[model samples]
Target: MQFICLIYNAEDNGPQPGTDEFGPYMQAYADYTQEVQDAGVMVGGEALQPIATATTVSVRDGKTELMDGPFAETKEQLGGYYILDCKDLDEALKYAAKIPDAKYGRVEVRPVMVFD
Candidate 1:
């Protein structure tokens, strides 16, 4: 089974701290990535640009509507994601908990739906 771990955090919190604070965060992630990679669980992952750079689109009445920013406004914004191959939801949850954001924000672990 595969799952996507969606990382979310507050945009108002501003850019993550510089080298001082960021160093620990990066080290934590590096450790987690290495552990998962060693276990053959990590498939892929990436960090996303800020929400301010996002564009939203919707279609209604046969017309396409384009709007600036994310689909919704919230204190927490989707910041990145990790796609993992896991034995099950429980295993995925364990991995999600290791994400640094899980301490201050949220890491939503959702299974991927595959179409036959």
Candidate 2:
């Protein structure tokens, strides 16, 4: 089974880039990536830029509407995601726990869908 671990956390509360702690924070993620790759479960993953860079698109009445930033304001924003190949949801969740962000943020584990 394949699943995606969606990481969410406060937008402006994380360590600022170029700050002293930022390097270690990024290193922890790198370590986690390496570990998962070594275990042959890592399919793909990446961190996203802030919501400020996002554009929400919607179609209503056959007209396109573009909105800047995310659609709704929330305490936590989608920070990143990791796709994994696991035997079951339980196994995928275990990897989600290993993510450093899980300490302070929330990780939503969802299964992937395939259609023939």
Candidate 3:
């Protein structure tokens, strides 16, 4: 089975990039990345740009509309994701819990849907 762990966090809380404050988090995530890769569960993962850089689009009444930010505003924003191959949801959740962001943020584990 395949699972995606969607990471969410408050932009106000985390360390900013390219600063000393970000070092520890970088090391933590790097260690986590290595562990998952070594365990063969990490299929892929990436960190997303901040929500300020996002663009939202919607279509209504045959017209296209554009928004400058995300689809909706919230205290927590979708920060990144990890795709993992696992035996089942239990395994996936276990992996999700290991993500560094899980300490201060949320890791939403969802099984991938297959079409056949």
**Candidate achieving the largest lDDT:** 2
Q: lDDT tens string, model 1, 67-103? A: 9999978889999999999999999999899988888
> What are the per-residue Cα lDDT tens digits for candidate 3 across 1-116?
88999999998777768888799988989998898899998999999998999999999999999999888799899999999999989989988998888988899999888687
RMSD to the hidden true structure, all candidates: 1.7, 1.1, 1.5
Cα misplacement distance, residue 93 of candidate 1 (Å): 0.8
Q: Can you write out model 2's per-residue Cα lDDT over 44-86, one digit (the tens) per residue?
A: 9999998999999999999999999888788999989999999
> The CA-based lDDT of model 3 is what?
0.90
Ordering by TM-score: 2, 3, 1
Using lDDT, rank the candidates from best to worst: 2, 3, 1
TM-score of each candidate? Answer: 0.90, 0.94, 0.91
For candidate 3, the per-residue lDDT at 43 reads 91
Q: lDDT of each prediction vs. the true structure?
A: 0.88, 0.92, 0.90
* Segments in model 3 whose C-alpha atoms lie over 4 Å from true places: 18-21
